[model samples]
Target: MSIPAAFDYHPAQTVDEALSLLQQYGDDAKILAGGHSLIPAMKLRLAQPEHLVDIGRIQGLSYIKEEQDTIAIGALTTYTQIERSDLLQQYFPLMVECASIIADQQVRNRGTIGGSIAHADPAGDMPGVILALKGEIVVQGPGGKRTIAADDFILGAFETALEPDEIVIELRFARPPAHTGSAYQKLANQASHYAIVGSAVVLTLDANKTCTAASVVITGASMKTERSRAVEQALIGKQLDTATITDAASHAADELELVSDIHGSEEYRKQMASVIVRRTINSALERIS
Candidate 1:
């Protein structure tokens, strides 16, 4: 295996210290969180940062808490924590479901939600779930902290709206309303376990079971994880049934420029998008009380 190029390492004890080191090192520095993504890229020599600012030692960056109407997750919280969180299972089980299927035991134990989203791999599971849940990414920079909606956070594959100096601090999602339900489904690559086609859906139904609101997001099939507005528009105000879901799922790839890769062809992914979206929406509908 190829080894990473020589680089300086800096361990940060606080967020401010990490920020300062980033500014000091400028473009030569890369923040090291869980190192699941960065280390592998480094090993392949795909990423050759001259300096690595290690924030793994930073205290108080890992937690899961409920605040009023929101669920707050610290940036450093690992996927394993999320997968096992009783609070998340009770409130937003889709997140737990999505987290549970990401990679395997060892990766989940070390891969962080923040780092995963920050890397913004189009195939990453959390981005689709966050988009469907309408979560907000809270980031801190040299100036201060700011929040970006998941809809606007991811720009494209391996890209985000975050500034070079910013550090993701927390992710926040509104507590789902009483009649709301959500689900995520994906066709994962065998070796890396990345999504080949993934769908995440959130639905809010009225007492009579008519869809009040809907959010449908697709990942891995495109250049970025994005909301399928066509699917969402088709579902809202309609009763979710076999016929309704089947028709709506047909639009899963509408307006999406599907990507063709070694894992699958664009045509195959388009077809699977519909299939996965149908299953995912059905799963969410079944979860609604």
Candidate 2:
């Protein structure tokens, strides 16, 4: 299908150039990173940006760096890059776990981290996974750079806290504490490239085999990927036992207003959320057990 005839395209070779175009076009222009999200939106006539500032050709933005306390992944890092990164595999296996289930090989080859976050699809997997780890997104705009917590950064489905002139630089996450393990599980729709529901669980176990801390973030619900505080509260300070897992999973939908489409109804999604939460928690506990 062809895009709307009224649209204009602007290819950019530098971040500065993209920012300049964004500033010039204001709400009339949309930034195009991988074109995975925007192209489809344009085709559906859901969005009609007068101009698109393309940043796909920009270089030196894709990298995975392991530092003293955290890992920094550049914005343009593709799902394939993340799924194949040995450094990520060694330290952040849950990220690789999530990345591997994203779409298919072809979409993974071109879709990017920044594009994913900025697209802010409520059903996207990375939002919940990164939120569970309490990651930060570094963004640069006319005012220079600043870091925003993942929770606060994603405002809603298909929306973010980014200004028109700003672009996400990278994502930073703390290295998992020793003996800690994590997992991501999702019920994906067939051939649609969207997660019906995705849950990321991070677990920390003490020397005596107790659950010291836990972060459970779930996406594809009513809101953007947000920590299930109720679930985390139930698990923290307890042993990662079957009883605890069952109890915590029940709290996964404490106050959420689930949305429904062709995939499921609100009630059906609520049930799946409980199932995915339990599965993620159990799967992660097994690794460190």
Candidate 3:
């Protein structure tokens, strides 16, 4: 399983270095953050970039910090680091849930947050999770820096709004307001280690024990991980009860074009989306209660 031959492997000590390489080589240049996705694609001859600009060596860019409003996570942060971060555990346990479900320990140790988002796989846990949390991506290019909302950034399967010269630097999101809680649940495929169905729910409750707002973003069950808008609209101002939960869950696949691989059928994934939506929402609601 050797990767295809490339002309150069440049370990960049900074984002400017990587951007310069990209500018020089244009389409033949590829930014390598963690190599979890690109390496596999290269092995299959699916990607043929002539130059790889490694960004993993950059320092001072792998931290989880809580600002006055939002929490900031560096792009180079590892899944294991996220899973073990005490600040994340207290402020955003849903991320820890995503970390635990991504893969086994070895993959988590090496797979980076930036690489996962850049790969933009429809079945990725964090992309769908960050969507639910309304995360924002901070990217830098030759011109300067720009921030894109999570919902707007992920365009489709293996696609994002990023330009060729852009490099993701960090992710940011406001901490879920008090009384808000979240959870992530996934059903993974055996061989590919991709999710057949993954759902992350972030529930914001009011003082009266009612759902003030919610987001249910599911992946692997569709062409791309998408927000269950019908479900979210159904939960607003509703009491977090079993009967209401059931009703909301019924709308899980209201307008989805699910993907069917050897792992499962369209009908099966749709059915499971409803189930995971119910379970994940309930689990998150429990935390808030």
lDDT of 2 by residue, 1-289 (tens): 5665478889889888888888899989998877787888888888888898888888878999988988999999999999999999988899999999888888889999989988888889887888888899999998889999988988877778988789998999988888788999888888776777778999999998888889898888666667889999999889877988999999898867688888889888899999999999999998774
Please provide the root mean square deviation of candidate 1 (C-alpha atoms, Å): 0.8
10 residues in a row with least lDDT, candidate 1: 113-122
State the displacement of the C-alpha of residue 286, model 3, in Å, after optimal TM-score superposition: 1.2
Q: TM-score for candidate 1, please give it.
A: 0.99
Winner by lDDT between candidate 2 and candidate 1: 1
What is the lDDT, from 0 to 100, of the residue 222 in candidate 3? 85
Tell me how far the alpha carbon of residue 262 in candidate 3 is from the true structure, in angstroms, after superposition: 0.4
Q: Which of 1 and 3 is ahead in lDDT? A: 1
Assess candidate 2 and give its TM-score to the true structure.
Answer: 0.96
TM-score for predicted model 3 compared with the true structure? 0.97
Off by over 4 Å in 2: none
User: How does residue 195 of candidate 3 score in lDDT?
Assistant: 87
Error of 3 at 71 (Å): 1.0
Count clashing residue pairs in model 1. Answer: 0
Predicted structure with the largest TM-score when compared to the true one: 1
Q: Which ten residues in a row have the lowest lDDT in candidate 3?
A: 1-10
Candidate order (lDDT): 1, 3, 2
Q: Give a tens-digit lDDT track for model 3, residues 1-289.
A: 5768665898999889889989999999888887888887888888888998899999977999988988999999999999999999988899988998787788899898888887889998888888999999999999999999998998888899999999999999887788998999888887666789989999998899888889899888988878989999999989978999999998898878888878889999889999989999889988984
